[model samples]
Target: MKRIHAAPGTISPVGPYSQAVISGHLVFTAGQIPSLGSFDEQPESFKGQVRQTFANLAAILETAGSSLSHIVKVNAYLTDPAQLEPFNEVYREILGHAPPARTTVCVQLWGVSLEIDCVAELIAKENGQ
Candidate 1:
């Protein structure tokens, strides 16, 4: 059977979707906005939105018993193409050690400038210790 995970202390989904769904030890997550338990339209700036999105991803992954380090792939969408450089800077910080296979694209999002979604594999601790 599959399992679903919802992070602690996060605003309930504003739409019809779970924070994450796990199947056979792999968790598929939905796109995460820069929202921090707020009902407002997110994404204030390139850097701000990117950071918050990663933080949100981290929280959901932690809740699902996984982490960014375990991520196997990431799909990032940018509203403003100009922020690619700054975005890469931040990405290097988070994805420095073991970067995952990723694709970054600039797409239109209801006229917004940022959005990100990633897939992280569960790295079970050796011996379950």
Candidate 2:
């Protein structure tokens, strides 16, 4: 069985998808964009966008009973190749030494410069079920 999750305070999905879904011990998150409030508004700086995207990803994972530290893989998309260094800097700061495996690629995006999605290990629920 699978469970869908939506994190409070995170931007709602712009399409017909849940923020994250869990099956077995794994939780997968939807691609999170740099929308601080509404999807119409995006951060101006590439660094800011990346930070917010990770923040959103963390929130979604937490909602699904996981966390940034539990992430095993990440898929990131960027509109500009120049942003890669800055994105990496922020990624290191957020994920620390044990960062997950990641792949980042330059791609055109609508209204935002970057998007990120991840998979993480789910924490056991109360009662150990």
Candidate 3:
């Protein structure tokens, strides 16, 4: 079992860290921030922030030979729990019926309102490519 880092220049990393890692048949992604191309601005829109965070997580998962459909678990941290409904709406859109086990909690943060971290089980058909 070896750790695989899911970083391919799309996801944002403020410090020295890999975006995600694959161990055996599983992929574990680091916390994702809402960042666009410039990587300096996190928009004021809470919904936009949540979407961007998921996008970052998706990008990392793609690099690890996985996708949102393969996600088995997700842990989200939000600066405000009031935005949870919007977040849930987006989650339903992305994951459809096959939702992963998830936990969302409020946490103190700066310049951002949401963060998403995920674990995915890479399908064997998509592995060893």
Error of 1 at 84 (Å): 1.0
* TM-score for each model: 0.86, 0.90, 0.85
Q: Give the per-residue Cα lDDT of candidate 3 at 43.
A: 65
Tell me, by lDDT, which candidate is best.
Answer: 2
Give the higher-TM-score candidate: 1 or 2.
2
Cα lDDT tens digits, model 3, 1-129, are 544454555644667777777887899888888887656777677778777778778778877878889999999998877878988988888886899999999998766778789999876684454
Q: Which 10 residues in a row give candidate 3 its minimum summed lDDT?
A: 2-11
**After superposition, candidate 3 runs with Cα above 4 Å error:** 1-6, 9-12, 126-129
Q: Write model 2 residue lDDT over 1-129, tens digit each, in one string.
A: 465645887867778888887878999888999888888777787788888888888788877888999999999998888888898999999886798898989999887888899999988678886
TM-score of 3: 0.85
In candidate 2, position 112 carries an lDDT of 80
Indicate the residue-level lDDT of 19 in model 2. Answer: 83
List residue ranges in candidate 1 displaced over 4 A. 1-5, 41-43, 126-129
